[model samples]
Target: MDSGATSESCFAKARKSDKTRRSWTEREEECLIQALKEATTQGWKSGNGFRPGYLAFLENHLKVSFPDSNLRGNPHINSKVHVWKKLYGSIVTILSKSGVGWNDTEKTIEASNEIWESLIKVDNTARSMRHKRWMYYHDWCEIFGNDRAVGDKAEHFAAAVQVVLTMTPELPNNVGMSLDELFSVDEGGAESTSVSLTPSS
Candidate 1:
């Protein structure tokens, strides 16, 4: 191969490796969730999802929180948000079905072996989620709960939100508190509060 071709091949391989190496630590994920909560409080979020440039805001927040992480908005932050939404949607679908339940304490889907067998038969993708533990489910709910599309799906999302609210006792003031108030009062506390999914007028 020519020297120019060899150089291009090496550069492509490096880029691919860098992309594949992107992974989030627990602290980094917490920071990301916090950043997203702050953005929602700032009214950058809408029913359809976060407004344009929110990814840049998230990138900057993560950069400040973990300077060595070198995360970018285009692929890194954007990809993470996409993944959270997809997973959150899947969990919502699972919980919306009959005979399926959410274990708030264990942060996992609760179902019988028969239920799993039936579900997997209909949707093979659900098989992987059988053993998955979603530690950040509530946080993702606060972020994407009200961001659902219109019609039947939106109603399903709302029902899932209600189920979460009923199961969660830590968020006593979920109703009246704005996202800003929720964050401010809990800022010094170890645990983050779940914001009300109702969009601000």
Candidate 2:
């Protein structure tokens, strides 16, 4: 069998495995947002210094939000360094997009180093994962789901946007900015037809 077909088969299996693992619930979203906020407030500079309190907070959240999720003893969430690194990615993405910068010199330096290290890790991870069949399977499953098609690029694009839309509400509100402003609301509080998924020729 061709590599592409083999990869697609694996991807389909992964998608059918569980929708819950692929996407987070609204409660989980709120918890994640709150956790990040609390962690930042507690001076969580990097993965190395991830506090025990934060881990406990997240552990409680997982227990409450996903009682059946077998998150207990899960290295992904239990390991201090691993959880911190993942949450660091979320912080970097949000703060960078919001054009927020650190005021203190120590914090600024730490944030800059974190961003640089994260970028290198991202590049290295992407390169290493591309060669692995499992990575291809997971990536394809995430983008196209079980109903993968030959030319469903538009659907994939729309799905990606929908994922972003879900995260928008979780983003922290800044002093002069808000995610709600991104959408143009009409008289009845409905999004206008101007925002479209179809590619214009």
Candidate 3:
């Protein structure tokens, strides 16, 4: 007998997924930053911001079992994502550009290379290409390289980017450097600044 229809369970998508964040300990933070430095030394500067390959490289390169932290598992690929951004700055970057995601790190890097190829092909800045299925080098690294896809694969990069943005000292603002270093605690639950040349008498 042909079943009329096999109904799908509503709770299918709601499986108990493992929490995907490792606490941003100092050592991991150091490894992450060092990875960035290595990339830079290899001509992978964040001058125009981040790149997908760079992002993948960072995540993958940080594959070492960093001594100790209250962290759990995701099979530990070539890397983990988002720890450095937490310790340092935000990833989104309003002023800078952005990257896109593919199925895996390979796809992501391949996508970036393809876009770069096209940009160089036309001999334009490819300025118009930002976030339209692809992105410019600067934009790709800053945006797509920073953001994750619509589902669970997104990990910690986005959060880290946010941290970077928060830390970034922009115009018409004084709250740079973690928003903590710039202010006092006794504001009574208000967001104000405390910049004075000297302590008043």
TM-score per prediction, in order, is 0.67, 0.26, 0.27
lDDT of 3 at 59: 61
Best candidate according to lDDT: 1
lDDT of candidate 1 at residue 135, scale 0 to 100: 92
Model 2 residue runs over 4 Å out of place are 1-30, 42-48, 79-201
Model number with the top TM-score: 1
Worst 10 residues of 1 by lDDT: 149-158
Off by over 4 Å in 3: 1-18, 64-201
Tens-digit per-residue lDDT, 1-201, candidate 1: 699999999999999878745778889989999999999999989766899999989988888978887788888888899999888878887787789999898899999999989888877879999878899899988899877542224433334455666789675764686544433443466433333444559
Report residue 188 deviation for candidate 1 (angstroms): 47
| Global lDDT of each candidate | 0.79, 0.44, 0.41
- Model 2 per-residue lDDT tens digits across residues 1-201: 699999999999988665324344556545554554555556643433344565666666667667776543334344533433443433333334323343343332123545545644744542322212221222222222222222222233334555666869775545464434543345364222222243569
TM-score of 2: 0.26
- TM-score-wise, the better of 1 and 2 is 1
lDDT, candidate 3, 34-73, per-residue tens: 6766776676654334544666566656665453433333
